[model samples]
Target: MLLKKNEIVEIEITGMTAEGSGVGRVEGIAVFVPGAAAGDRLKVRILKTAKTYAFGKIEEILEPSPERIESDCPCSEQCGGCAFRHITYAEELRAKENRVRDAIERIGGLQNPDIHPIVGAEHADGYRNKAQIPIGQDKQGNLIAGFYANHSHRIVQCDCCALQPKPFEQALDAFLEWARKSGESAYDETTHKGKLRHLYLRMAEGTGEVMVCMVVNGNGLKGEDSLAALLRERVDGLKSVLINSNREDTNVVLGRRFRTVWGQDFLTDRMCGLQFRISPLSFYQVNHAQAQRLYALAGEYAGLTGKETVLDLYCGTGTIGLSMAGRAGRVIGVEAVAQAVENARENAALNNIENAEFLCMDAAEAAQLLVQRGEHPDVVVLDPPRKGCAPELIRTVADMAPSRIVYVSCDPATLARDLKLFRELGYAAGLITPVDLFPRTKHVETVVCLSRKNPDDRIEIDLDLDELDITSAESKATYEEIKDYILKNYNLKVSSLYISQVKRKLGLEVGTNYNLPKSENTQVPQCPPEKETAITEALKHFSMVPFK
Candidate 1:
């Protein structure tokens, strides 16, 4: 039967996409409906239809799914952030676990994968550590700062969101009232004319330290100083107030240049007793409470001993490395971002940790060099970006043959791909744990433990607690000793030039087509002379020689 726009059709959703869209077969053809989840048999109105599939919206839910529940936030349906808000927490976990399992089996081509129960958060709601609200004016010209609407750049004035802590919501409300009185025009993406572009607020949930950055479209921040001063007085936890001017239309980044007007440039957050200082640009996990659970699982997967040397690749701000520092002999982390490396170093110092050290370098290059130097880590913990481990990095790691490997990933397809590479390198999968850090979203974080195969060793773990001594500090000491031994044998400090060279040769290139800076068409270069030089200097670590 042909479906018409806004015509309610009851269909059973069979599958779900990574973007949280539901899939249903309509006359042997697939139809996609947003705000729908698997196990949902509902009446959805067809919004638009293509030759292959149809787009829809839920007009009336004739029969609610067993997993379905009322969304906590009023704006949950409209906002793009939370996708699984309507589902119960238990069901959400199951869905996330299934997603991971499916990705491994279907995308990774693994048979009967051993996926463990998902690690859950202590608190399901109000666990967010960071929130970025785009500043824009309402229909009545009232200044507002909130998230964009679903599938649109238009700002949605969300005064109440369940994910953000009470302090964050209060601060935003205060800003909204102040901005309305102050007559600051919200940045209009459509017109490219407005004073305020984004209000970036990040809080260290454990410490109650808050960092706020007001992203504007222009260089000069007129009437921002007074606001900053007021914020310092009103906001108890306000540590940093910055202005980031991003004039570009594209949403690649907020801005590069930042001026700190109040307090410090960054804020500190603690996870598993490890302190991590985060800046405006630094990427940290959003859910603080849930992230702790995820990291704990990763540490368990690593099976760290005090005598073991551990290598943490793609160690953003060294959260995992620093957290596991006490349990390991030495924790050496490699990150591509220099700023993140600096932050990681600062975090280590702040925590008074001497055993952990971080370096700014490409993972592939560092691995190859470590292998060449005959100083390989006993255990390797990798938490890579959504892209997962590069093939070169995988090959290098395989050759090194770490005794134990803990792989944490946000994208399952990539995880499976990398797992396949590891399996080929004579590693056997030990355990796979999926953690739902981001609820109401299709995304899931998974930690997989893989050990170098020993033909004679098939040791069985005793599940009984009384059999093992949990009170003893022997495990911690053993992990630390191994780490120290590895670091002493292998020099940690190496030049970034090699890593930079390899990345530039193989990694994807960004240009004008991707809304990047184009200089040839202009009289002067697109970037300011000083800024260009600094960027060039930074890229040197990645082997990207600056364009002369």
Candidate 2:
């Protein structure tokens, strides 16, 4: 019973996938239908089919799910944003929590994990402090500004979006009206000849100060003053108007060059009782109110007692670290982006946070550098990108021996992968809380607390030298010996877990089972080839294995 493209089939949606698509089955093969929800009965047309799964489009909803609701925004169906807008907020929260739990248990190989309920947003709509709408022309050659349609670059002409505040809509409308009058054409990705590319807007949630930035293909826009005046008159709380020149033929929205046209080049936003200067390139969270909640949860997980030295990895603009600076003895923030580090340092100074310091380096390299300097943190906070922490970074953090590691992640699958690595390195995953930062969207923010397992509690085996066969020290390398060999020969400081993983892959029994119990243990991935070579070389140098 293989499904064919354009084949209409009846399905009873049973659940939801991580991508916010509804799960249904036809003859035991899973079919994912977008715009569908759990508990819905639908007639779907198979768009694509694979050996094990299929993708479909909802043709008709024979029976709607109880959690399903009518979306208020007309563009929600066409726009790529807000995948879960058709479902109730309660259902969204439940789905997010379940997603986190499933990732931890099913993917991370944790049993009965302590996963808390999702913290729902206070206001689902109008919570976003930033909006970047693409400007283009409709089929009639009329100026338009809106979001891209789902999986396509085609602009869905929208004057407003439900996720953004009303002021953004007004600002967008003003820009559209002005562009139409000025006869400026939208930038085409194919031709790359138009002037206007995008309208980037940011609003200070607390102060109601708005910053409008027009991303143009050139240095300046024609009649910029008139456009600024129209925005100031039409949009309340308008504070700054600027232009970002992105001359390069790329898909990136903001360029490196910026010129203020009307007001300041940056706007100030207050968060966690501290004021922050936000430029167009700053990585501030879109949902400010929910960010406060997320940071508060991270702080709570940090459990600062005014005497702990906290290391904030991936500390964007020093927000998370500065949020806890008042209570921490010292806060060291590390970020890879140079501009973000500059902003973080300035933010620390702006907040008068003398106890906090910012450093520009990759998270793993910074942690290793700190360790080299004999600097140990009581708490290490990780807010890595969506790909999650690198295994080497996780190993470094574990080697730093922080009492607690607070992981803030945007992607559950990656978080689960990192958590598994942490567990292998003697960290026990603890309370994990999911927060609905981006409402009406499939994305969810999660904070996980990992505490180092007590070394004394680990099972230790005593061996008698007389009962064992006589062997030289090089016959079987100790973990330290293997590590030293790798570092000395290859200049690669490999983790003991990596060596153990290589050993297991070579059909060698590990000395001790640091992994989960056999029943709970899933197949952990082997060390990457580069590191595996180092591990194999170490094993050979220690005479643990004969030459291949």
Candidate 3:
């Protein structure tokens, strides 16, 4: 074996992974070392090893990269909350830009894609407007409150985090004091017992309004009034204090039941020159300033001309749609969460935005409804969850025939996959801009713009069939034969709809009557790599170009 557990070795960090780990190679084997940056020489201790790669931790730094810097937080390494704390902000932005570019070229199969430089955060520290901290007890049976240590559930005691505002520290101190004085035990995940579960704090960056919420095992707490009074007195700009009851034994933090102990149950914040009511259960970006930048970039990609209609899918609380409402003739926002839809309507009314409307439905269902109503939008914006958009939904959006698609994604791999599908649907991927919303972490947000490909851009080929060596029977492959080959070789069943789509993209002539009727419903599964390759070969066998 080349390596063993607890083995120490010296390696030079050459690159970084998408998960913010420094990568080094020994005998062509990759070693991932956390808390290490590129261009750094360090002594590392191997913790685990596999056939092709190994995992290790930095033991000592013999030399540091020029991008490396001294972290201000003492618990940064132990807390695992911030991955780029030891590196400069410039390096973080560059790494994020490279990550986005690599995903598009390597995963999406795009060659030399146009990826702009990353938009760096104006303030790297104290930029987070929301904080969810776990409450636990130390080995001495004393109360401790902080974030989890790395991947483990052990809480690393922290009085303050650099990512949160100054008011959060004061609120933490008050909560800790109140919990200890009231003799409330912190919830233990292993035994599934105790009262206090977590402390959730949110701040409105533009308005400076603060909200304090407590997650507990029960509905109410003893001395709740005193705790509220203490927080209001200690934390400035306090607007709301609420309690969330999570009686279940699951890892999920917030429960459905919420009780207002003091003030209102929601907080209001302004984004993109509009006011939005934020509830505890509502989905909002943690970084307020960077979100503004992100929305502005989306608006630029939409290229609204004041006479065009825009459709936003998975529009959380209608932030992006509302931001572009002024420029577009009309904006329609669709969200699955009922409460979020209500909040979106309320926000529209609050801002007096007359051109925006929100509906409570899933993206696919809403797209189908719009198509049934014969509504066509000039631009479509998609902001989906980490799993990304479903292939069916992508097809539905393409059916809308929107001239432009602005996709806002948090996961790069999923974005690349979806972009590939969009490419096959006659859209040309352009200008992908990565935004550093979460500076110290591995997470990155990207805004990609895809324009409908012009008919003139299609490739034209002239060939002499008489000089071809292959026979007519060998050169022709039926669609059914192609499907069977894919299934037999890859063990993946593909839908006729998907095959038709691919054939159409490859410039193959599908008969006018080849499409299924509207009444025929079927499930089209995602195409895996092996299946995609087989399908491409089938297209090639029939003398068609599989890709541009």
Better of 1 and 2 by lDDT: 2
Candidate with more favorable, higher lDDT: 1 or 3: 3
* Reference-based TM-score of each model: 0.79, 0.83, 0.83
Expressed as tens digits, the lDDT of each residue in 90-142 for candidate 1 is 87777678888988888777799888898876677787778888777778877
Question: Candidate 3, residues 1-548: lDDT per residue as tens digits?
Answer: 47888989889999888988899987777999988999999999999999899999999999999999998899999988888888998998888888898888899999999998899988998989899999999999999999998888889999899999988999999999999999889998988889999999999888889999999998789999999999999998899999999999988989888899999887899898889998887788999999999999999999998999999999978999999999999999999988889998999999999999998998999998887554679999999999999999998898667889999999999999999998887678998999999989889999999997654442112123223333334347655676677666555444454555565665655544443333323222344344456677767755665343
Which 10-residue window of candidate 2 scores lowest in summed lDDT?
Answer: 457-466
lDDT of 2 by residue, 147-259 (tens): 99878889998887888998998999888888888978899899889999999999989788899999999999889999999999999888899999999988778899888
Off by over 4 Å in 1: 1-8, 37-39, 50-52, 454-548
The CA lDDT at 132 in model 3 is: 91
How high is the lDDT of residue 228 in model 3?
A: 98
